[model samples]
Target: MTDPSPTNFAAPWEAQVFALVVSLREAGLFTWSEWADRLGRQIRPADGPERTADYGAWLTTLEAILAERGVAGPESVAARTEAFLRAAEATPHGQPIRLENDPLYRP
Candidate 1:
């Protein structure tokens, strides 16, 4: 699902989500400490040491924060997420995904 470059990331989407978090904070939507608290609460891995990227959870939390702050509706985020997944699912393996429009998960 990924052909990564030289980076310590489990998946490409993790970097995208991380970048979105930083951008949101830069846009004054939330503070870094608040993100720490929220993300800490969100991370409850079943296996304590089986570490891997959890971009799905990260994106879910991000959407929740956006909803809490009125930056975007939860339904909107869900719709976009579903569409993104649908696009990815339809794409052949090892090919680039193509979304119908600009993603809602970006700033």
Candidate 2:
């Protein structure tokens, strides 16, 4: 198989989210086929791909699956997103970004 382009992700967080999704799947949370179908639907939604971050659509799909599977709820995801953003904003630049211990992140 051909290697993916080094610039496939628009940002570092996108790559991290992609890795998280793969790790979840590898941990038996879902099958490869399930991920393929869900991600395909997200990539080609009724409104078509949004003119935004490359893997933003993929992240949405992963969240939806996680919510449906009871791994996390919509509110939890939103809360964590907000919490992470807040943490990032508070952190000084040039330091490694870290995920905060958000009460919303159950896992």
Candidate 3:
């Protein structure tokens, strides 16, 4: 299997989520179907205001899934969330840098 270190992931959130998923899978807390069902239920909105996707809602869903699987406790989830937010802040916005001077590219 590939290394599970955070540095192996291109994105911090991906690493965090991957860790949670792996932990859950190893623990055998729930089958894949049950995990999907729980996540789907969390993503869905109850009757009231217009339903929409939001960052908080997405994080909540992830947290709920992790909790259901017993992969992460509240403190761990909070720490991961903080790290995710920090990574988001550090990441660049807009188009990626173009390496036009590289020999691999001929334009």
lDDT ranking, best first: 2, 1, 3
Tens digits of per-residue lDDT, candidate 1, 1-107, equal 37565665578878899899889899988888888777766675556643322677678779889898888997887777687887787777898877743343343
Every model's Cα RMSD, please? Answer: 6.9, 4.7, 13.3
Per-residue lDDT for 1-107 in model 3, tens only?
56565355556665676676667667886677775565566667586554344344445766776666576878876765565555555556663334332334345
lDDT-superior candidate, 1 or 3: 1
lDDT (tens digit, per residue) of candidate 2 on 52-83: 43577778888899899899999988877798
User: In angstroms, what RMSD does candidate 1 have relative to the true structure?
Assistant: 6.9
Looking at candidate 2, what is the lDDT of residue 37? 80
TM-score of each: 0.63, 0.71, 0.42
Error of 3 at 36 (Å): 0.7
Residue 42, model 3, lDDT: 62
Error of 3 at 67 (Å): 4.4
